[model samples]
Structures are given as C-alpha cells and as structure tokens.
Target: MRSLFKRCMSALACLLLALPAAAQPLPYHVDPDAREILPNLQPVPAIRFLTTADFPPFNFRDPGGELIGFNIDLARRICIEVNVACTIQAWPWDQAANALADNQGDALIAGLSMTPENGELYDFSSVYLALPGRFLTRAQAVEGFRAETLDGQKVSVRAGSAHEQFLIRYLPNIERMEFDDELEALEAVKSGSVAAFFGDAMRASFWLNDNLACCGFAGEPYFRPDLFGDGLSIAMPAGNDAVRHAIDWALVRLKQNGALDELYLRWFPVGFY
Candidate 1:
C-alpha cells in the first residue's frame, strides 16, 4: 500500500521538461459546492506543514537547496485562502509521520496514505488530488484503443502492483505481460512487445515527456479510488477539526476560483487527466 505514495525523485528533470498544455482542461478533485461552516477564531492558529523533499513535483529541493514543489505551493495557497500564517518544513521521509505525531508540525502534506489505520491517527482533509491509472500506447495504436476492444490483446504492467491487480480484477480477459518496474512495462509498449502499458499516470506522464517518445496516452484515465486508494490528503492530528475544516474550506474555494486549476496546469503541463 505504501507503493501508492512512491514517486519518481527527479524534480529538476520534470521541471525542465514541463511544458504548458494550455489546450487541455485540468482535473478538479474538490467540489465547488462543498463549503464548510466553522466557528470563526478571532485569531486563527498558524499552520506548520510537514513534508519530505524526495518526492519530485510534489515536494523537493530545487538547485539552490530551497524546498519547492506542487505541495509546497498548494500549502501556501491554502494558508493564503484561510488567512493564516503558515510555515513548511521538510523532514526525512522515514521520520515525517513520527515528527507529526510528536507535535513537530500541525499537518502533513507529504502524500500520506488515507488508510483506515492512519485515519484513526490523523484527521485527513478531503482528497486534494487523486492519481489515476492510464494506458500508454504507441502512437499508431492509440487511434482505436479502447478498454473493451483490447479483450485478448497484450498489455504490460508492473508485477504485483495495484495496477496489475486492477487489471486482473476488471479486465481479466487481456493478456498481461508483467514487468518488475514501470520503465520495463513502458518499454514493452515502446518496442511494440505489447499493445499498451498501464500504471500510475503521474509517473507515466513524466516518462512520456522525458523518454518514450514512441508512445502517447490512450483512452480516458481510469479512476478506482477503492483500488488506487484515496489519492492525496493533508493529515492533521486526530480531532483537529478547526485546522482540517479551514483547509477543506480553502481547498473548495481554490477550486471554485480557478487558483487550483492554474497550479495544476503549471505543474502538470502534460496533465495526467
């Protein structure tokens, strides 16, 4: 399950490759109608967000050793929306959760899994981003690629992954060629060894932009929150309703006013959606 939070650690490469996809629409996870009515605090408490710097595009250090990424930017935006003082700090991934539990930070925005066990320990803000499974196929094969149409066709996936399990559970008819990692599975598609490959959209987007010039995304992205798990949410100390509610309310406002979409486009120029 921890694999859900695993991400490529090449923030600089991703940033260099990111190109504006102004022609495509961005994905929205927050509902515009979702609003919170919380008791107003005369002086709202400051929020300190804890994160790790290894996950590229989400949280990572730039060339100057300054922490910067999508999550950092979003955390600041949430603070701005709620009119609260905010500070972001990066810790080693292994120690981040323990630090949060030790009262080192008010919230964690380091892609914490919203699992039942964690739900008991932390109050999670509404899911801010959900990664989807997508198919990457050779340019020519994309013309008529359809999930239903690929009944017995060969497709590559990482061995024993959630993506592999998803294929086994849903598209059982397809002949799966499992690889030990995403790059191998993608390579099978690039070399025409398989008709397509299925895996995490974010990683695939990075590869599509950086390597694997032979393939492109095919069909709409598949969203199985039950299988993929809730994508990404800010985790706060359990029962911290004030902070949680404020962040949730700010997320809704961010989506409604287009600030969130702007950030999405800026970070994910080749958007997974």
Candidate 2:
C-alpha cells in the first residue's frame, strides 16, 4: 500500500503540532473556475463514510475513544458542503474496501490506493493529498543543501520502497544505502553515516519534529506520482456519478475557499511541502 497509512509512524506528536496557520502553501490545489454540476443540491440523503482507526493523523481514535483525524474532519465538512447528514464508521482496514463494495458505505477515505486495479472497481475523487519524497539531513547541513551536488554522496533509503526506486531513477549519481526501514535510514543520517535520508516527506516531518532534533528537511519535496502513485482520494462504488460529482464539486470549493488548506495546516503543522 505505498500510501500515507503504510509509511507514517504513530506520531501523535505531529498531530499535536497542528497550528492555526501554515507558513507554506498547501500541496493540493483545484482550479476555482472548474466545476461539477450536480443534478440537485442534496446529492444523497446522507453520506456513510468508511475509514480505519489504525491510520493516525488521517483517521484514528482519540483518547476518549471517539473517532478523530483529518479524514474525519474532512468527511464532516464534505457532508456540510453537500447539505446532507454525515455518518462515519471505523472499520478494520482489511474490511473497509469490501464494506464499501457491498454498499455498506457511501464513500471510502481510508488511504485506498488510487491504482488501475482499484479504479476498475471504484470511482475516485480528486487527489486530496500526496505523500511526497524528501531529503532529510543533519540540521547543520540543511542551510545550503543542493540536490545537484549530491553526486558520490551517501544517501540512505528504505530497501524495496518507492522512494528508493525514485532515487535510483532520478538521482543515480549518489551512493545509495538501502535499509530495512526508514528508521534505520534516518538513524544513519543522524549519526552522520550518510549525507541524507531519502523517503516519505510526511514521515520525515514527523521524525524531524518529534525527537530527531538533529535533522531537518534539506530540499523541496519530490512529487513523483508515477512512482509513488496518486495520493489520498475518496473512493466510491463504480458508476456512482451523483456521489462522485458531489464530492468533487465540494472538494474544489473547499480548496478555493481555503478550507482545505486550513485543514491541512491543522493536521500537519510542519508542512511536508
């Protein structure tokens, strides 16, 4: 699943850093002029959103056992935009897809892969978020880091990861050190054994702020949808045009009105891009 749910660690600390405003622009954008015409104001009487409790910051349970996360808030806002009641339920990740397929839910926002295989079975909304690749370097080396000058330098990456494939394809000049996991790669950077650790930007952001004070982002986030796949999107049963149009229409408005950016900032304080 090369999605955020798979790459991200349980960094409640990153969620805690949610702030009132973001210092940078949000990653996802929608053209204000683009529009989707729905047949009626209320596309559905109510939307039953299916998600999972295991993916933190995106969808997870709060200390009070209440379902809470960026996805939860976004689903509520979507319901408001469509002028319909919203009912969200947390299901086991393995069953969420089948539940949606069986008409048990109106939408699935649990980081389902937006791949060709899934596209045949479900209709997807516009990409709401993308987990970008990034370079994490020691804090002292971040001041003037240059991707072009990384030739012959040791850069750590997780073995068999999309990020590693990206590094091999685009930046083949650098020395690659493959690790079993991102933590090992990050540790290599912290220990000065590598020039940088290349992997998911969101995870890098969390590690940078949570406890790895010795490092920081070294360059702009790398967006390679072809390699990493198109990011988080809401999925619905195939041919469900009404619901799909309603969600897409609402998403554009949310992005234009800055509501989406606000949600992004509130959830991811240390912006990955």
Instruction: For residues 1-273, write the lDDT of model 1, one tens digit per residue.
Output: 234224445444455445655556577887656656643644457889999987878887776788878899999999998888999999998999989988899899999999889878889998888899999899887777788788999999999989999999989999999899778788888888898899999878877766535888899989998878779899999987778888888888888888888888777777788
Off by over 4 Å in 1: 1-18, 211-213
TM-score of 1: 0.92
RMSD (CA, angstroms), candidate 1 = 2.4
The segments of candidate 2 whose C-alpha lies over 4 angstroms from its true place after superposition are 1-22
Inter-residue clash pairs, candidate 1: none
> Number of clashes in every candidate structure?
0, 0
Measured against the true structure, the TM-scores of the candidates, in listed sequence, are 0.92, 0.91
Q: Model 2, range 1-273, lDDT digits (tens) per residue?
A: 334444553446245544444486577657656866654655578889999988877888766678888899999999888788889999999999999999999999989998889989999998889888989888888888888789999999999999999988889999999998778788899889999999988877666655446888887888889887778899999998888888998898788787888888888777888
Judged by TM-score, which candidate is best? 1
lDDT of each: 0.83, 0.83
